[model samples]
Target chain A: MRLKTRPSHREKQLSEDKNFLHRFGYAQELLRDMGGFSNFAISFSIISILTGAVSLYGHGLTYGGTGMMGFGWPLVALFCMMVAASMAELASAIPTAGALYHWASLLGNKRWGWYTAWINLIGQIGIVAGIDYSVAFFADGLLSPVLGYRMTETTTLIIFALVLVSHGVLNHVGIRIVARLNDFSAWYHLGVVLILVVSLAGFGKGELQPVDSLFRLGETFSDKPYWLAFLIGLLQAQWTFTGYDASAHTIEETIHPRVRAPWGIFSSVAFSFVAGMIMLAFVTLSIQDVHAAVSADNPFIFVISQALGSTFGQVVLWMIVLAMWFCGLSSVTSFSRMMYAFARDRGMPRSDWFARINKHYRTPVAAIWLAVILSFILALTDYFIKLVNPDTTYTTLAFLTGVSVVGLYVSYGIPIWLRLIAESKGRFTPRHLGPWNLGKWGRTVAILALLWIAIISVVMVIPPNQNAGIALIMMMIVLLIMDLTYYRHHFPGPEAALQVSPEELARREAEFHD
Target chain B: MTMLGVLLILAACAVALAIGIIANRNVRAFNEETHESFLGDRKERDAFEDPSVS
Candidate 1:
């Protein structure tokens, strides 16, 4: 009794290549405007690890997994970096503003392409909001603690406005300045953080705790279980890695970016992971009490103060303040670029206006300003929330951002999975990846990274508390409404629909092939 | 150390060595092929659009 073969739905979809042709207007010249590999790395690192300072909000996550888990924060950093490296290779191959969505379209059916773009759009916008809100949170952190002044809604508004305007002006000046600034930020950020970590480790007068003590640290917090700690740390790690693809988003503006942009994404992520791990290890070894330190107080600052006294601590504090500013400002650069790209594709509202470039500066000044305003608005809302409920403020925003990051990982994974499937069928092979090649291991690592991202995404959106749950639902509703009403109506469907006909494709193929 | 940590440290070292080796290979290849440390070629640039075949 031979069983009849069942027709597979996905196979049917794959056979429909008529719907798979893509729009390819982005010229190689776009890459020339982008600074270089180092600038790309700096942009990515600045946006990703800087805001991860909020991990103090969820330190319980790292508390119980292993004696090694005490220092697992750094390992988490390493994992995030590995994920970035995998993503970088793919981005280098397909240097498009649409990024992951376009990648999905290239490797899979057309129907999935629109949905992929939607998911990525959601993630990118959420990141912008998250970064802007982080700016407010960190700014509030400095003013509130040191000045002993309560941060008002107005203050947050003022901070947001100033930052937005500054971001707008910087983007207006074009790529060279942005790249230079990013380079400066990379060194400044690392140098300052290094000083802070070393000072805390070597000079802190507080009773030093062994790294082993952090293993059961959550026991002292609220008697949480081991799984809870592991869960929290997973979320924290995801947060730290939220923007490791800043280079991918701005490939349109980089020089020789086809080769260098991927390096930027992979290398920056690699640097962040290694550097972050070392920093976390030192901090964990030097921490007084995980619970007390990560409290409403400036945890790292608290540690530094205990170790180095007010004078030296003050200097470190100033450095941290500058770092946060640079981090926030650099994020503006990335977010604005993402916004401009989305707008350019007519995947967003007011594409004509938002996608417009300043002729002299050759930057998307309009999109930059739009992002700045929206970010400012989000920051103002965050400030109001904080004023209403100080205890839940930071955690709430962090959790929201975490949920949004899920959208990013999903965006990254779908394209990769499509590529993996294609490769299995001998439809894809990367011959020019050179020594950066991971071979079969690339697929394995990518799949692992995808699984990790999927698990954490689910964990993040689950809501840690009843209040958080309610807020999450409301935020989703608001975001959906905004997208449907404003963006959906305005978006020119499937930017890839602007296809060069078979004739043009043939001409270009023949002309370029030899 | 945990498996992850030990593995990561080893991986990092391996990656560093691989990069060094690749850099050396690139330099040598360029020198042998074209008598220069810089190896970028117009043909290579032409191949940029479709790297799958290179």
Candidate 2:
């Protein structure tokens, strides 16, 4: 029969996206046009192999020689892949902003989510500080001579502020610009890696270390036992592996988030592992003297300069610095979104302001500035510490690096652990929860991931970074006090968002309509 | 010393290989249908049916 057909919506997916978010009792405030690649792009940009691998290249060389770059990297990447896969399953099941916090809440209780949110926030703050500060210090180390300017502590702090502000403004405007930049960033990072690998290989024909040199392990700087020092150096890979959770944080802005977000989380880590290996292989092989490279102001740049001469090294160093800039910009986007999502449910002080999305931009403007401010303050530690004792400042850098890796891993571990316990008691099956099921391997993978996290959490906080260990314990105690006295009486948790009716959710979403 | 070094390298490689086997099984679960119990909380479902948002 020639009956009138209902006008088919060109985008059936938009309706489904809104429906999914409504099921969680929140309106889709952030705009969502992010395709699968864009979803992958955010996480990859944050991982930024060039950013972390190069910045911490000297750390790895000092603690475990070159073996950590060769062996320790894959070892940590293996565990990180397991972590990413496990997280992908949760992200697929409950695709939302603040996905880690919500996963813990639903899997266990509000307490788990509360702890996860605060710890994740701390990690984000540390990462934002670390990434921006690294760019400043790395730039200072590589370009001070070339640019004919000094990057003293005060000067570098100023540079850090300028970098943080640009990222804040870019993120405050909208996700569209940030997403485009991240996509470009992903390509920029890989292209630079390719160029460096090829250039170093061509230039370093006779200068490169033997291939077997990659497996050579020792503790040249620290007097710790070889095994212990190697364990500490593994922190380098863990630090590089941080922030892939950016994919989960941006779920609301991603199209088909349940499927796409999980892919984003896992694929970013997978790609980074391979690409980072190749880049590190060439860079480390090009090192003529491990001791000199390890002791240099900027070891990664030193190796390149040694191989390809000062001029070529300076050009390559500039390229790497640009990648770090992109890396920091993406970190700001990820960090601010986590803050906004946590605030959405009164998880922070003055939640009303932080949670508000700008009408014109559909971006979290207040949260973006909050991230920038917090990181800027934290970045000042370098200036103050260097002013006091420049010799011990790298220890402070190690603390920041430790805080980020340990904090994020703790947050990631909680949900996976809680989910495992729930499934063991037959609360739910992996098949029923999400599209990304581990099936029978759920227990084994979860256990392995939990074990990996436990080991690194301890190893990362040892010796020189004991300040991080103290900070973490104190942070936990303070959060517990705050929760027991304040949040317990007031905060109803993310589950409160889901207490809305279908009609009410529709009305709330309508508020975002143009 | 050389033998121990080879063993350390091999042990790390072995760990990666074992993890890789599990990782393969966990690859790219897109294009699969997810179960509809995401907002599976019984209380939350009642909230959806009820007239108010708490």
lDDT values of the candidates?
Answer: 0.56, 0.80
DockQ for model 2 equals: 0.17
Best-fitting candidate, scored by TM-score = 2
* TM-score of each prediction: 0.76, 0.91
The number of the candidate with the highest DockQ is 2
Residue A335 error for model 1, in Å?
A: 2.0
For candidate 1, the TM-score of chain A alone relative to the native chain A: 0.80
Interface RMSD of each: 12.7, 8.0
A61-154, model 2: which lDDT tens digit per residue?
A: 8888888877788778878888988898789788889888988777766667788999998888888888887788777776677679876777
DockQ score for model 1, please?
0.04
DockQ of all models, two decimals each? 0.04, 0.17
The 10-residue segment with the lowest total lDDT in model 1 chain A: A14-23
Report how far residue A192 has shifted in candidate 2, in Å.
0.3
- Shift in Å, residue A481, candidate 2: 2.3
